[model samples]
Target chain A: MHRTNSLLTELKKNKMLFLMLIPAVLYFIIFSYLPMGGIIVAFKYFEFDKGIFGSPWVGFKNFAFFFQSGQAWLLTKNTILYNLAFIAAGMAVQVGVAILFSELKGRHIKKMMQSSLLLPYFISWVVVGSFVFGIFNYEFGSLNTLLKGWGMSPVDVYGNPSIWFFIIVGFYLWKLVGYGSIVYLAAIMGINPELYESADLDGANIFQKIRHITLPLLKTTIIIMILLQVGGILRGNFDMFYQLVGNNSLLFNQTDVIDTFVFRALNQQGLDLGMPAAVGLYQSAVGFIIIVSLNALIKKINPDYALF
Target chain B: MAKNKIRRIDMLIFTIIGYIVLGCISILCLIPFLLTVSGSFTDDSSLFEYGYRLIPQEFSLEAYKLIFQAPEVIAKAYGVTIVLVFTGTLLGLFFISMTSYVLHRKDFKYRNKFSFFFFFTTLFSGGLVPWYLVMIGLGMKNNYLALLLPHLFSVFHIIIMRTFFTSIPESIGESAKLDGAGDFTIFARLYLPMSIPALSTIGLFIALTYWNDWYPAMLFITNPDMMPLQYHLYKVFNSMQAAQIVAQKTGIPVAQMPAETFKMAMTVIVTGPVILVYPFIQKYFVKGMTVGAVKG
Candidate 1:
């Protein structure tokens, strides 16, 4: 009774704060929590007329269909492999750019370079898709045009499955390297100038200072960023894949990820909600396990870094 | 003296290599945009003949003319996008800041609980199907609210805002409370004014998200009139029929149309504003990203 009375008094005292939180709380409940309840659709054979709860359960048949189709392994492999490639390549390029940016001598030139580098990050994927088409379209693409002009046979980039791995990773890095570098740049900026000065006093060169001091300090930030990325390793970037390789069946073997698979399954003529939802649940369950385990690990090592 | 000379040479070599690498990357970043611009201006026949180039072999304004002639579709898209961007950014910023303010309150008893409430959503989600069903169930199909609502309150933005709020000294809010200012009043009259940088940073992020958004529109909007700019451009890119339809409506010969150049032209037109305004607002993005990373 006393605990309930104190809780009521606390609520009364901070009523305005609670009031301010209502919209956000309601947003999450409607958008996030409610959908969580709808995850059961994975096990159901859904009909539009029947609605989510009214749909008849199918008992893992959706997962059976997915695995039977062989897309389950393909998409899972593609998603994880692509993400691992992106994470590794992105770190190297971004950290390199940040370090080089620090070494840059001229302010105006640095600003201009930074602006140009960041230009791609601002535009929509649709625009990037057009750029890809302009450059890689078999007949009219700039690359083919140049090849034909040079007395060489034109390359059919889109028809080829093997090259798209490079194309997707290239565009991903192109769009993000500038944006990603900023975090590292900020970390570099945050480092004590005194450390660098002392290194200089010891007759250390720029490379030596970077190797001994800058890199060691940057290790934590890099690890945290990588850990954060690893937590979402199952979640493919739907926009990037969809925009770049839209329904290109030839490239599907190399390019298809969990996101695009789910998207196609959901949007295809006859909605098989069960299979797609099953795939989605698979992604979510694995993703959730990864994140929870990672958080637990981080909390054990340093609570400050734990996402929870 | 010999060691000093070697050190100077090493520094020079490093600087030279840095310039070359950074310069090459910058050029790689810029050349595609240059090709798009050049292709937009290139005559139809020449574009087909020569492909996209750094400079147009034969300059023509036909693509731009065709678009502007029956400008209603493009203009409507722009209008839809502008409204979504402005309204979404304002409302999202207000709600995000308000929530952040409450969460940042040292005196608030449930701040940690509330913080966890927002943060927990990031860890796991019900995935796309359920979320799509919820959106459909809410009658968001073909509705502008679909675009506005889903994006209005990102947990990432909330975290960034809360971190910004925490940076302000607690004594200010405490003294304001002592002066008989209520929480809302203090948030509105004091904290809001003080957090312009945070507000603008988050506002710009929200605005950019809305402006570049096509996924929501692609999912929810089947109505042609309701399509936002990016989705409209997407449609133009995917279907030659869209360009042909526009050309036919304008009484231009479909055979004479620059469908290839038209796509590039549309890309330029859609992306022009962002490129133009990027230089001015990019620093805030950098600041927001850096701050978010530091404590996120």
Candidate 2:
């Protein structure tokens, strides 16, 4: 009774704030929470005539189909491996560029280089796909035309699946290195200048300064960034995969992730809703566990970096 | 001294390597764009003969002319994109900022609870199938709302905006309250204006997301007339119809048309505004990234 009275008083006191929050509350409820409730579709035999709630419950059948199909392992392996590659390559390039940027002397050159590097980030992946096509297309592609000019046989990139892992990672870094570097650059900037000054007084070389001071200070930021990325390691960048590889089944073995698989199963495979939903639920549940456990780990290590 | 000489050499080597590395990466980043532009302007026969080059072998405006010949298609796409970007950015910025404002209030008892409420969505979701069903259930198919709604409220943006608001002195709000100001008026008259840097950063991020959105359009919009610029470009790349229409409108035989060059031109046209304005707005993006990194 006392708690109810206090809650009423608090509600009365902050009526406008509560009112202002209603739209966000409603938005989240509709977009996020509603779908969360809809995860039950994974366990059901969904019919078009009957809604998600009305669908007949078929326990574990959808999951059985997914696991039995052998796609579950492939998708999981591809997603984790590709994300690991992206994170490793991306961190190296981004950190390297950030260090170079901080060391470089000319302001104009730095600005120009940074701007040019960032250009690819602004363009859509579809444009990147077009660029890839322009370079790799068999007849009119630059690669084939150059090969033909050199009196060598033209190689078919799209026909080859093994090369796509490198291509995907290369493009991911190409688009994101500049953007990612800015974070480390900010961290580098935030480091105490007096440390550098004292090092200078000690006659420390630029490389030593970077090795001893800059890198050490950036450790926290890097750790936090890696942890953040690790949390979403299961989620594939659907835009990049879909645009670059598209409906080309030839490359699906090399490039397919959980997202594209779910997408194909939903749109292309013709109404096998339960299986896709089951895979999605699996992805979400694993991703949720990863994030929660990682957050706890981060909290134990450094409370400030913990997402929660 | 020998040590001084070694130090100078080390600095020299580092400087040279820095320039070389940064220069090469910049050129690699820029070469594709240059090739696209040059390819778009190259004559069809030359493109077929020599492929894309940094400089056009035979300069021609025919591809662009073909695009302008059917102006309505590109114009309508630009229209849809513009409307979506403007409406989505404004609404998204307002709601995001408002929510952040409430959460940033030091006195708000439920701030942590609300923050968690938004943040939990990022950790898990019902995945695309249910989200798609939810949109379909809401009758968002073929609706522009489908495009606008999904990119509207990002949890990341909310966190960034709240962090920005936290930088503001709380005494300002406290003083405003003493002067008979309601929370809404204080937020509107003071907080919104004070938070322009954060606002612009988030606004540009939201605007860019809306501008570059094609996934939502692909899922929801089936009508050709409803396509945004990026999706339209995707269609042009995939389908021959966009080129065929150009060929028909210009009275050129489809066999003789510059379909490849036309695709490149369409890409350039679609991507042109972003490249043009990127230099001016990128600092804000960098600022946003840094700000998020600091507190995130």
Candidate 3:
């Protein structure tokens, strides 16, 4: 009775704080948790009239069709591979640029370069697609013009399936590297200046100080970021891939990731809604499991770095 | 002696590794933009004659002229994007700050429960398909509300704002409470003024989202009048005939057309505002991230 009274008293004391949180609570309920009720559409036939719960149940049929499409394997491979490549390449570029930007002392030069570099990130992928089309179109492409001037042959970058992987990767790096580097630079700046000053006073030069200090310090931030990204590895970046390669079917072999495949199979064909939902369910489940497990591992290694 | 020797060795190796990596990454960041920008200025006739380059042998303002002629379409897009950015940023900042203020209050009855409610969305979502269905069900299709409503309230920004708010001293609320200030009054007068840096970061993020959003426009906005600037540029570059029509309208010489350059020029033009203001934005991004990382 006494414990219950104390608990009630505590709740009463903090009532205002909780009251303030009501709108945010309502927001999530409406937008997020409620939509989870629609996940049932994955298991059902998804009739328009019947609605999510009302739709007829078809046990694992959606899963079966999703796997049978043959696009399942292709798209899964494309999505995972591209993401792995992006994560690996993006990490390398960002860390490298960040360390360099940190080492340079010229504030003006650093600011100019950082701003110039970050400009591409501000533009939408739709605009990026236009830029790609402008430079790569067959007859009027700048590549062809330059090639002719140099008495060299102009290759059709758009038609060539092999060339797309490089172009898309380049585009991804161009749009993201500066922003990612900025994040890392901020992390580096947060490192105590005293650590560097002490090392310099002890007659340590720049390379020795960085090798001893910088990389070790950035490890936790890097690990957390990596784990966060790896959770969504199964999900493709629809905007970048779709905008750049959407209309061009020939390039789909190399470029078609899971998101695009689902979009086409579901939206374009008006085919089985169940399969795409099942695919989405699979992606989410796998992603959730991976993230949880990864967090567990991180917790085991260093509880401080674990997201949860 | 051992520590000093080790430190020197570490510095040498680190500098070597750091410099080479940064140089290569900087080039990677720089070269493509240069190619695109310089390539844009190169004559289209010359472009077909030669490949893209770091510098243009012959320059023409054809692309600029063509784009400038059909200024109405582009102008409308710009207006839509700007209005969305302004409205979304203001609304988002208000709601986020208020919500965070409530969550941060120690006397809130169900603060943890509410936090969980918002935080869970980030952890688990119904994926894109269901969200699309919900939008369609809500009659948001072809509606401007579709663009604004779906993304107006961000859980991430709320979390950041709450984190910043939690760092504020409790005495503030106590003093305000003593003065008989209502929850809204305290939030508006005391908390909002103190959280400028955090607000700026969140506000800028909201602004950028509205500005850079072609996704919402693509899915919901089929009307040409509703198309945003980035999407307008998307249509222009995809079809050369669109460019030619603009050229015809503008009365620019056909042979002097810089179609490729115009697309590049458009990219430069649209992103110019962001480039100019980025330094100011960066300061807030750095501060907000630090606060978020530490509190979170």
Candidate 4:
């Protein structure tokens, strides 16, 4: 009764503040929280006329169908493996570039490199997709032209599936590595220069200082970055995959991921009922589990790095 | 003496490798853009016959002609994109800052509770179907509201905005309150102006998101007249349906258009303005990203 009295007083005191929160609160309620209940559609036979809740309930049939589709394992494997590659390679390149950025002495040269590197990050995926098309298109691709000019056989970048593993990863790095490096660069800039000076006093070389000091100091940032990435292992970059390898079912074996697969299954197939919703729920469930587990693990190791 | 010499040698090697490797990567990044621009200028026949050359073997304005041939459609898309960016950015920055201000209010005892309430959405979301249904149920289908509302406020933006608000001394708000400003007045008159750096950064980020957005347009919008630039480009590049749609609307022949240079020209048209506008807002974006990275 006493606690309730105090809570009422507090609520009355901050009435304006609470009023300010209504927009955000209502947004979350309508867009986020309400839709959360819609996850139940994943277990239902959704009809346009019947609606989400009005649809008849079905259980795990969508999941079973996805698994039986024979592409389930491939999608799962591709999503996880591709993310792993991105995490590892993205970190190394980002950290390496960050350190390189810090080492460069000429301000003009540094600015130019940084600007050029960041150019790709600002452009839309639609633009990047077109650029990639230019490089990989069969009749007028840059690579094929070069190959032909050099008296070698031209490669079919489109029809081939195997080459896309590199293409997807390369394009991702090309597009995002600059954005990623800013994090490491910020962390690098924040590091005290005195630490490097002391290392130099100890007669440590550039490589040793980087190995012993820079990388060690960056350990937490790197782990946090990787741990952050771990949550999205199940979700694919639909924009990148869609724009780059798009509709080339021939490359599906190499490039098809959960997002693209579900997108096609939903939009293209009109795959009966709520199968796309079911897959989305599956991705979310898996993502939630991984994030929670990772947070708990990180908190145990170092409380500072816990996302929560 | 030997150790000193070895250290000198190492630094020299590192510098050499750094310059070489970084130079190579820079070249690799720049060349494709150059190729595309040159390819855009090449005549239709030469593009397919000779392939994409850094310099056009037979230069032509055929591609430019095709795009300029349909000015009305392109103008409408541009108008839609600009309006989307303007409204979305302003509303997003206002509502987000307003919401974040409350969360960061020094006297607000329920701040943590509300923070989690907002933060929870980022960590967990109901999957796509219900979200789509909620949108459709709300009658967002084919509506401009669908594009504006879904991305208007993000949990991540709220977090960043909240952090920026916290950095402002409580005394600022307190003094404003003493000066007879209401909570809303203090936020609008005092806090918003004082928070220019944060405002610009967040505003630019939101604007860029709107500018680059096609996902919402893809999902919700089907009207060709209402199509934004990015989605329009995606359509043109991805399918013949887009050309057929254009032909249907404009009654122009797409058959005679040069496929190679025409598509490349479209890429330039859609992307060139943003690239030009980017430098002005580059610093703000970098500031926002740094804040998000370090704090988020």
Candidate 5:
């Protein structure tokens, strides 16, 4: 009774301030939490008029179908492998570019490199898709044109699934190297000048200093980033996969991911909703485990960097 | 002295290699779009015969002419995009800033509690289906509200807004309170005007998001009339039906459909404005990066 009385008094005192939060509070409740309630549709057969709650429960039947489908293993494999590759390759490129910039130390060149490199990041994935098509399209494509000039037969990039692994990874690096490198640059900037000065006094060359000083110090940021990425290994970059591959069944073998698989399965035979919800539930459950464990690990390493 | 000489020699070698690598990569980054632009200007027959060329053998405005032939569709998409971006950014800015202001209020006892509530959403989501179903339940299928509502208030944006607000001195709020001003007044009159840089950066961010956004638009909008610019171009590039629609409208398929350059032209038309405005707003992206870079 006393707690209730104080709470009411506090609410009354801060009525206006609280009122300002009403829109945001309402927005989140309606959009996020209300939808979260609908996740139960994964276990239920949802009907349009029956809605999420009134739908009949089907136990793990949805999950059975998902696991039974050959696509489940493939998508899971693709999602995890692609994410790992992207992280490893992306981190390497970012670190390399950052170190290069840190070493080069030319104001004008740095600015030019940065602005040009960042251009791809700013452009839409749709435009990037067009760039891919422009280069790789069999009829009048730039790659084919170059192959002709080099007196070699043009490779059918579209028909081949294996080539896209490189194409996708290549574009990923090209787009993200500049943006991702900023963190390393900031980290590099934060490094103690005295350590570098001392190394310089000891006659350490650029490579020697970087290997000894920069790489050693960057290990933490790199690990933290890797750890953070490990938590998201189950998730895929839906935008990259969706735009690049786009219903091309030929490329599905190489490029199909959990998110895209879920999307396609939902719409495959005209809005079969439960199976997709099952997939989402599976993703979220696995993701939750990964995240919790990673957070625990990070806390053990350094609580300061723990996400929680 | 020997070490100094070695260091100088290393720098000299690095300088040459660095420029070559960086310059070549820079050109590679820029060249694809340049090729696309060049391809868009080339005539259809010549494009088929010779593939893409740096300079078109037979220069043509046929693609642009065909695009402008269905002027209404193109214009409608641009209008939808502009209106969506404009309204969404303002509404999002107002609510996010308001919520942020409340969160940053030192006197607000439950600010951390509220902050966690917002932050928790970032940790997990119900994923695409349930969210999609909810929008459907709300009758947002084929509705413009679907476009605005989903993109409106991200937790990331709110947190960034809070960080910006907290950076402002508390004395300002205290002084405003002493002047017999309300919390709303202090936020609207005092902090809002003071937060132009934050507002602009966030506003540009929101605008860019709405501009580049095709995902929600793809899901919610099935009606051709409701398509935004990005989705509009995406549809054109993805399927032949779109080209048929344009050709059907213009009666211009007699010239081999011009599908190749038609897609390229659509890309230009949709993304041209963003390209033009990019350099100006690009710095603003980097400015806010370090502070709020950890996006969920």
Candidate 6:
């Protein structure tokens, strides 16, 4: 009772702070938490009038149908593989660029490169899709144009499903390399120059210094980024994939990931609602578990680095 | 002598690797932009016959002329985008900063709970499908509100605002309280004035979100008149048939039209304003990202 009183007293003392937080608090309750109550829609038919709570409980029916459709394994495979490739490739390119940027001593070239690299980050995927279509269009695409100019037969890239993985990966790299490198570069910049000065005094060359000093310091940032990425490993880059592939059923075999698959499944048929809700629920749940576990592991390894 | 020899070698190797890496990064960004720029000016039949080229075989402005002739559609899109971006940025920055000011008050007992209220949303969202359903339930579908409201405020922005607020000297607030200034007055006069960097960063973020967003417009808007610039541009760019048909209907010469280059020109058009403001925005955003790197 006394403990409760002290807590109440403390709360009252900070009443203004509590007042300040009320709007955000109300926002989340209405938008975020209130909607969590509707996850029951994943299990229900979700009649608009009847709403989530009063809707008929359909049990595991939605999940069963989704699994039975045989898209589950394919989408899961595609999502995981694509994300893994993105993370792996993106990290390598970004880190390499960051390392080079930090090492390079020229002022004008560095400034120019920084500005130029960041330009792609500003472009929308809509424009990016147009760029892709322009380059890959069967009749008039740049790749084909170049090939024909060389007296070689132009490849029909759009019709070829096999080419999509490389094309998609290439497009993703083009859009994100500069943006991702900025973060790594920020991390590199934050590293104490005194450390480098000490290395210089110790007669260590630049390459040796980077190997011994810079890479080691970058490990924490890299690890944190990778772990954070692991949480969303199931969440594909929906915008990129959607824009790049569109509804081209041919490339669905190679390109369709869980998010896109769920979108199509919802929109294609009479709004099943339940199927996408179930998949979305599944994604959130897995994501939550992965993130929580990753946080826990981080806490165990290094408490300071743990996200929460 | 050994150290001097090693220094020269190190600089040589560093310069070589640096130039190569920088060159590749620049090329990666530059090539697509070049393709878009060149393709926009290239003749349509030529494009249809040969494909997009870095160099135009028969350069023409027919595509530009068609767009300029019927500029009403693009102009409306631009107007809508500008309004949405301005309104959304101001309102979002206000709410986020206000909310963060309260949360950062260490004396507030409910700060932790309220922080959790906001923070928990980030961990487990109802996901896109249900949220879409909820929006539909609320009858925001096809409404401009659908585009503006859902993303009016983000949890990420709130946290950054809170961090900035927490860095403020608490004595100012205590002194303000002593002066009988209301909490709102203190916030507006004292806190808001001091946190321009935080405000600018959050404001730019909100503005960018509004400017770049086609997701909400795509989901809800089907009316051609109501479509935002990015989404309108998206629809035209995606369907070659759509662009060709529009070109034909507008009485553009099929032979002279630079359909590909026109697309590039539109891209350059849409992205032009943001690029002009980018260097300033980028500096703040880079700073914000590092400070907000508190979260993964």
Encode model 1's per-residue lDDT on B141-255: one tens digit a residue.
9999998998899998888888888889989988998999999999999999999988998898899999999999989998888999999999998866577668767888777
TM-score of chain A considered alone, across all candidate predictions: 0.95, 0.97, 0.88, 0.95, 0.96, 0.90
The full ranking of all candidates by lDDT, starting with the best, is 2, 1, 5, 4, 6, 3
Candidate 1 C-alpha lDDT tens digits along A129-248: 999999999877889988988999989999999999999999999999899999999889989999998876777887897899989999988988898899999999999999999988
Question: Across residues A203-285, which tens digit of lDDT does each residue of candidate 2 receive?
Answer: 88989999999998989888889998999999999999999999999999999999999998888635858889999999999
**Candidate 2 chain A: worst-modelled 10 consecutive residues by lDDT:** A266-275
* Position A23, candidate 4: lDDT: 97
Error (Å) of candidate 5 at residue B197 is: 1.6
Per-residue CA lDDT of model 4 for A65-134, tens digit only, reads: 8789877798999999889988888899889988998876778877777877888888888888999999
Output the better candidate (2/3) by DockQ: 2
Provide the interface RMSD of candidate 3 in angstroms, 1 decimal place.
3.8
What docking tier does model 5 reach?
medium
lDDT of each residue in B208-235, candidate 6, tens digit only? 8788888888788877767788887887
Off by over 4 Å in 4: A1-7, B1-7, B245-252
TM-score of every prediction relative to native: 0.97, 0.97, 0.87, 0.96, 0.96, 0.93
Residue B61, candidate 3: C-alpha displacement in angstroms: 2.8
Best of the two (4, 6) by DockQ: 4
Worst 10 residues of 1 chain A by lDDT: A197-206
Steric overlap count per candidate? 0, 0, 28, 0, 0, 10
How does chain B of model 4 score on TM-score?
0.94
Scanning candidate 3 chain B in windows of ten residues, the lowest lDDT window is B286-295
Model 1 TM-score on chain A: 0.95
What is the per-residue lDDT of model 3 for residues B1-296, given as tens digits with 9 covering 90 to 100?
87778766765676566556655656666665677777667776676555567787778675566667778757887898888888888877887788888877767655677777777677677766676677778788778787777667887788788878888999988888899987778888998999887788778778887877777676677787787777666666665655665666677765666656777777766766776787677767555545555535
Local distance difference test values of all predictions, in order: 0.90, 0.91, 0.75, 0.85, 0.86, 0.80
TM-score (C-alpha) between model 4 and the true structure = 0.96
A129 Cα displacement, candidate 5 (Å): 1.1
Compute the lDDT of residue B67 as modeled in candidate 3. Answer: 69
Native-vs-model 2 lDDT?
0.91
